[model samples]
Target: MSVQTEINLSQVVVRQSQKWQQLALGLLCMASISSPQYVWTLLTKPLLARLDVHLPVLQVTFSLLIIFQTFLSPLQGKLIDRFGAQRFIGIGTLLTGASWIGAAYSQSIWSLYLLYGVVGGLGTGIVYIGVVGQVMRWFPQQRGFAAGMVAAGYGMGAIITTLPIANSLASHGLTQTLVEFGVGFALVGWFASRGLRPAPNTDPIPSATLTTGRHYTPSKMLKHPLFWLLFFMMACMSTSGLMVTSQLAGFASEVGVSQVVIWGMAALPLAMSLDRLTNGLTRPLFGWVSDRIGRENTMFVAFALEAAAMTLWLTFRHDPLLFIVLSGVVFLGWGEIFSLFPATLTDTFGSQHATSNYGWLYMSQGVGSILGGPLAALLYQTSHGWVPVFSVAIGLDILTALLAVVILKPWRKRFLQH
Candidate 1:
């Protein structure tokens, strides 16, 4: 073979190796950050007793963390783009871990808000958006599947630690558990963050698969109508998942669902365990499907499944067995948003500024947290039932599913042409 051909093959091999390494590192970073948001449900009861507050009051912290994570992401994204992922994640790890340590020592509800809500939010946001951007840049060809896997890490990462955290709250107490795990989260996240680096630059492939050949800056992408539609759709999707995430433990107790035990495990913890598995699996599973079908097509099926799952969940919510099973189904349908939307946005707008562009899109999740967290808690307070809340979530899920095909697909195609 010619020396030139050998050199080209070597370059391809090197690039391939880098992509896989970056992907794995991103997944580890995601796992390191997962417990803060994902396991917040397990901490709610103890926090309420310790802080002596009503449920709605305590939920504000959850909303604040999401708010900080997402509302500040555009800035965080720009910084990551400018400074590099390693430094960004290093700082994030310190904040992420320290928030838990701080929360461990916190005596008041307000202090928890400052620690987990504000500081933790910023930390996780940096790592979350940064890793996603890395995945998109590395696998422009398989953006959906690539983003799905890393997002799955965030979704499923808690699986390994969920039962342990629950057990610790019972055995060791929340304070010690938070302090110990906080240190672990920081060390693990920092280790993973150091490995993160941007994908090497390359010319656009001659057979490029991007629907739009044009690259839009974050500001321009925000101005586009399609972006707003996706934003609203995202808010809907996020709300459904967030409501289940933040309110399930309390809501289950109210209805006496948590009292029931199946196979010697409490219903709430068992459901949470199953939800973690399904949530993590759905991202990559549907993302791989989208690579073959289409983003909107996959969105339709997944969102519809969530709507159906919510419907069934509400219908049989009184039954602990069905409740645990359906909660998993709900998460299975909903978790793919992290993968699909970022991949779709990168596909639509090009990866030149994917991190920043997604930063703007990421804010919709904060909006969902407000709608789903404290607000949903308030709704339950007023109506004194889960029916009204579930009804609203089911409606949003169905609406987004329809919009995906009817609006997103055609509009995306036309936008690309222009």
Candidate 2:
């Protein structure tokens, strides 16, 4: 072969290696920022104990974290796009770490709300959108799986820290645990950001993928009825999932299973760890399935699964063994929304403004956080039981599942045909 040809082949190989390396860095960034949301349940008991706050009042912190994480995503996405992913992600991670450190020293509930809730949410939001958007561009042919892989990192990252945080809460207390984990997340996420670059847009999409070749700006995308349908569907699913996520520990205690031990491990932490695993696994698993079976079909299956698991969970709330197993099942169904919605959105609107477009859809989670987090707690307080709360979640899950296949399938098909 000619030397020019040999050099061309070598450069291609290097590019392939760099793409995979970027994927790894994206995963690390996601995992590093995951703890704030996932581990909030574990911290609630400690925070309540330290601050002597009411349950409904304390739940606002959870809502604030999600609200900020999602509601500001459009702005964050714009900034990441204009300024570059690496610079913003590194700064975001540092802010995330600092939020935890500041929260550890907070002497009042309001202070915790600002530091842990607002600052942490902003930081995680930057990393989440930046990494997901970058990776989506990196592997256009395998968009579902690549997006799923990093989304899984966020879903599952807390598995590594759950038990450790639980132990530290038991031994060192909440203040110390937050400081240590904060430092670790900051360092790891910053290091990962340094290795990431924006994905170039020269790669072609395979003909098999049903993508709208037109790139729609966020404003145009918002005017379509189809976007509203997707927004509603996501908001419903988010409400159900975030309700369980933010309120699991409190709900477990209400059901008399919080203190139950299975296999020498506390049921809450054990169940939480398993839940994280399944939550992470479902993103990629369902994402890959959607690639073949179609996104709406996959959503129907996964959302239906969550509704079923939730029904059984409420039925057998007293069984600690079932509690641990079923929580994993619940998450297995719900977590795939992270993968499915983004892939579907990008497929429909095109990737030119994918991050910004998804930013609009992601705001649905903030709506869910409000309805599911503090408001749900207030509902529990007023209704004087958990049944009403769990039942509401079940209804929303079933509603969303039906919408996915029935309304979404036909509407999206017609929209894309144009």
Give the Å shift of residue 28 in candidate 1: 0.5
Model 2: colliding residue pairs: none
Tens-place lDDT digits, model 1, residues 1-418: 9999999999999999999999999999999899999999899889988999998899999999999999999999999888788899788878899999999988999999999899999999999989998888898788889999999999998998899999999999989999999999999989988888778876446332375457789888888888898889999999988988998887788768886999899898888989999999999999999988888999999999999999999988788899999999999999999999998888888888989999999999999999999999999889989999999999999999999999899988786666
Write candidate 2's Cα lDDT for 57-113 as tens digits: 888988999999999999998888788899999998998999999999998999999
Q: Relative to the true structure, how large is the alpha-carbon lDDT of every model? A: 0.90, 0.90
**What is candidate 1's TM-score against the reference?**
0.98
Q: Which stretches of candidate 2 lie over 4 Å from their true place?
A: 1-11
